[model samples]
Target: MSSTPAPAPAPAPAPVPAPAIADRPPPTFRQKAGFFAMIFGMFMAILDVQIVASSLADIQAGLSASIEEISWVQTSYLIAEVVMIPLSGTLARILSTRVLFSLAALGFTVMSFACSLATSLEAMILARSLQGFFAGAMIPSIFSTAYTMFPRRSMGKVSVVIGLVATMGPTIGPTLGGFITQALGWHWLFNINIIPGLIVAATVWSCIDIDQPEPAYLRGLDVSGLVALATALGTLNYVLEEGPRNDWFEDQTIFRLAVLSAASGCVFFWRAFTYRQPIVDLRAFSDRNFALGCFFSFVVGIGLFGSVYMTPLFLAQVRDYNALDIGIIMMVTGAFQFSVAPLVGTLSGRMDLRLMLAFGFSLFCFALYLNSFLTAESSYWEFFVPQAVRGVSLMFCFVPVNRLALGTLAPDKLKNGAGLYNLMRNLGGALGLAVINTLLVERGAHHLSYLSENLTLSRPEVQAYIDRLAERLGDSLAGGVAGDPELAAMKLLFQLAQREALVMSFNDCLLLIGLTFGAALIVMPLVKKPRD
Candidate 1:
């Protein structure tokens, strides 16, 4: 019966691709070494920024540059680095991981030499900018390699390494830079990169054999998209870094740049979605876990980098601590994180990542809440425990966050996803730093005004305190060894008021950071556990 030949059975649905994290062979020794070499290079690159940060004073004096010009040493690097970060994915595709990383390491090494030899502000800034470009190229490459070179079974362990390197550079940078500068001099900061850079370059060149170059991709490159992205990231970073310094939108330059950043960002996103082969496939974000994971990552940056920035600043400005002392205090956080990393990595593989993330954020909130109690008289002991909590929290946060972000990405989209993930983290940090700085200034001013309003001669308590202070200084004033008694008392009152105001501002800042972390928890439900 030719009666309507049985409709051909619909072709079996194409097999759904599983995440790469399933059971797999362990990485061989050479693969491990090569991966480590890439990580080391990344660490060195990230460390360079913070190392120079601690030694900027020396660099300024050595080069005899003005404050504005000397600031470019950092500004230039940051602008270049931010611009290059998102582009790294496309660049890697064109050059291949092995070739791209090798060139980056080599270029970075040469630039370090150039920077060390730089004698003028112009020379140093130019060298630093170039160095930053190469160094920025290496960062996402390390992240991408971690996913590509290792199996899913090993990513948890890889997360441990990535977290350490990510945290270690900023955490220990000031300490290392201080020691190096004191012992060897500021030049050593740049010179130190030479040997390590060469070794990393050589090791990566020899050991990394996978991922052949797809030079043809370069020909089809999204030129307009690249420009839009560069403008968006570069201008945005410049605005964030310079806004607090320049009073934000009040400065015409910053305001103009802000507009440019927004316009370019819009263009970049539009092109990324519309283009057949966009520079970065924003479509990876369609995965619910990845989108939520990135949001968590952004919050992580706010907590991680914000704490690093605020603590040192408070120690330096309010506590009168030296760079080395501040670095020492900050190192405790790094130490705590390092100690717990292996354990956290192990647990992440066995536990629900969402729970780990929740626990981590809770710890961050607790630490920040505790930190909000900081007083002008607070010492290293006051910070030690909170810093330890923060360190441990970082371990818990990074491993699970990374797994959730990249676990579901298709192999082809892994690099692009990593780039965007990293960009969000850095953006969060920049925004946090800018907002915190502005809050410190604005909140401090508001607190000062409020505190000052009640501090008047008409108030009995105010008058009483002034009289007491004036009487105490009377003997010295009579002998002419001290300044005017009335003036001295007024000075003392003003100093006390200023101190109180600053303390309040710092507390408010800490509270805000804590609340932000707590609020981020609402996104937790969006992440799904990896399928077995």
Candidate 2:
């Protein structure tokens, strides 16, 4: 009967309340120093993604690589980076932030040096792949640290710094690359990382103290899941990057990789859901805001990378601008992006993030719409307003989208969620580029064919155009003599038609990219307004 005295069972233990924004301690100097260093490392990582883009020709010539082989310089990096991005979450947990980030920075630096010394295409590809794997680890770790290290109130400023770095790195990449390649050489592209990389590694290793290494996580490594993930992502990236160039499934290699990617992807997903400790925790998607945020990130990626890719290309192919000229023209976007950072940081605190995101995406769509009017005669001034609008819009989009995606994740979930979030953006960029390339080729051919069909010699306009061109050619020739003036005129006419068709295709691609942002707008309301 005295057992009644033991009653009430010591009422269930109350859960510990999370620290309030005000209650949380400010980041110490060490944390701040470590964070900035990590941010620098992240910039290097992302910048390298496109630094080689503008200077691919130089690398090609340097290594005596064929047109097809030289592309692997970029492709190998992208494929390897994609595989490591999602896997970084697990690695970070097992190794701890300090150890993982330091190792990544050191490894990335060493690989950069190796790349600079590469004497063959094979060596460059191997070095670049290893470099990308290390680079991928640095990127997500910065994102996760930003969320976990700072308090809620400080996120506005923290987001601006991280957002500026993330978006600016890629935006200004080609510009920096072109300058470096033109003034120095392509080898400097990799060489530039050595000094900065060493500093970052040393600083981060000494200063970072975010969390302890979970040796238990290493014990539950999920080896099968890891292999499946690597296979799935690596094959998927290769297929996406090479598919457009290889005529998609028409190439046997692409087709086989596509199948392998699908099968490995299925295995990866199955392991993620059933395994006790998944390599990438799929449960993050169960958060409605995170899911919607990732979609926004994907669309933003299409805008961010697609524009960077297309603008330089149009200038190179249509306007015949060299790397330096294109870099000069591209400076507008980077300049505006820098100017808008402070304003975005201020607005992030006062404005409803959803509204800010809407405004940002609206500007992005408007900018793309402006670009759809591209002509072969278009020059820097023609691109100025659109690029500026895009730059401003990206700052707006990046800050809010990043906050909305990872801001609400629990500390325990932030690392995995950040990895997944970054993976989506990169995937979007890869897929967007593939689709853009395919569209450019197919649409260019269709337009060219149509123009040819309508410009037959039987047409009165065609004959008149030919006669005028012949007369001009004859007048321009030395001693007023021309060899088969009509034949020369025909050749000139075909060249003009080809140029017009290519411009039209560029216009089509820009319009489609704009429509993608428009579609993203439709889904904006599904994102729940974040809690105050």
Candidate 3:
């Protein structure tokens, strides 16, 4: 009994003191330089896609490619990019962040040069796909490092730069490309990456020195999981890109791809849950904040990419603005994002993130509503305010949503979580663009039919408008307007009807976008706030 009492009376161990804030090691100047290089690489990757947008016609001409073949230039790049994004997490783990980032930058640089030198459509597509693959590899690293490389207190500051680069690259790509192409020729668009890419590669290789490779983890590589994930994302991306263009399920290829995507996705998830070391960890979704953050990310992606797609289409198609002018108008949105993102990031440190999300979504919805009023007569001035609102709202949406999703994960899970989080946004963009395209076609047709039905020269108002248009044409054109007045009037009426149909369709699309943002707002409360 005495022995047991003596054993029980062992003294308590001394209390361990928590490390003070000042004791934490800060990032060195070299690491910061490496980060900016990574940002530059990411910027180039995203910007390349947009830069090529304004110059695709020239590319088509230079390669002697058909319109259908030219579309593959973009399709190939996008498909490759999407497939590589999620895999980056696993790749980084195996190769180490430093090596992976350096290789990605180098690969992207070489591909960009190859793209510039491509002599045929096939060559261009191949190079572009390779470029996209490497580019996608760089994206998740930027965000993952924002959380993993830096301290939590500095995340808002880090995110500001990443968000700005991400937001601006696409936002201003067309404009920048237009200028480069105009001054330096289309080949320069790809060649332009040479200097910057070299700089980035050198900086990344020489500077980044943080992550350590786990050779043991590579031994457990999930081959089946990798193939399944690639199949799921690749086929899904193809379906999204081609669905509306091909009338979705009506086209056998799209239908087949969609089925493959679904099956592959099911298999991937099953593997994720059952495998001892699956490539991806689906368990991350079980976190409430991550799940809801992803939900909202998908919604915001719709607004982000959808608006980018829509506004340019509106400017080019409806207003007949040149690529440069369209780019300039869209830059209004980017300008606001660039200026406001830093401020928002600073405020994020001190403010209630939920309230910020609410405000952001509200402002975005209002911008969409404003866009709903667009007409054939709408000009840059008309888009200016809405685009600015949209720019600010983007910063608000991304910063908060990013914090919510990945902020609560364990450090080990950061890479995987970042990959999945980004994948959702890209998928959302793809799906949103598809839906918007389908909507434009379907709604435009519906509006056309309805408008045509009432334009029989039966309505007096219709006749009067046509007569007035004819009179104006007669006054303006030489040789009595070249056709019979009645015939000309009818033709003009049809044109007007078509334009009106397009405007109505766009308005409908914008309204739908607005409603989607509002829905996202409704889901905001599901997220639990993390400590600052």
The number of the candidate with the highest lDDT is 2
- Native-to-model Cα distance after best TM-score fit, residue 186 in candidate 1, in Å: 1.1
* lDDT preference between candidates 1 and 2, better one: 2
Error of 2 at 511 (Å): 0.9
Give a tens-digit lDDT track for model 2, residues 100-210.
Answer: 999999999999999999999999999999999999999999988887678778888999999888898888898899899989999999999999999999999999988
- List candidate 3 stretches off by more than 4 Å: 1-24, 471-483
Q: What is the C-alpha lDDT profile of model 1 across 42-104, one tens digit per residue?
A: 898878777876778899999999876787888788788778878888887777788888999
How many clashes would you count in candidate 1? 0
* Pairs in clash, predicted candidate 1: none
What lDDT does each candidate get?
Answer: 0.84, 0.90, 0.84
- Kindly give the stretch of ten consecutive residues in candidate 1 with the minimal lDDT sum: 8-17
Error of 3 at 61 (Å): 0.4
Better of 2 and 3 by lDDT: 2
Query: Which regions in candidate 2 have their CA more than 4 angstroms from the true location?
Result: 1-22, 475-482
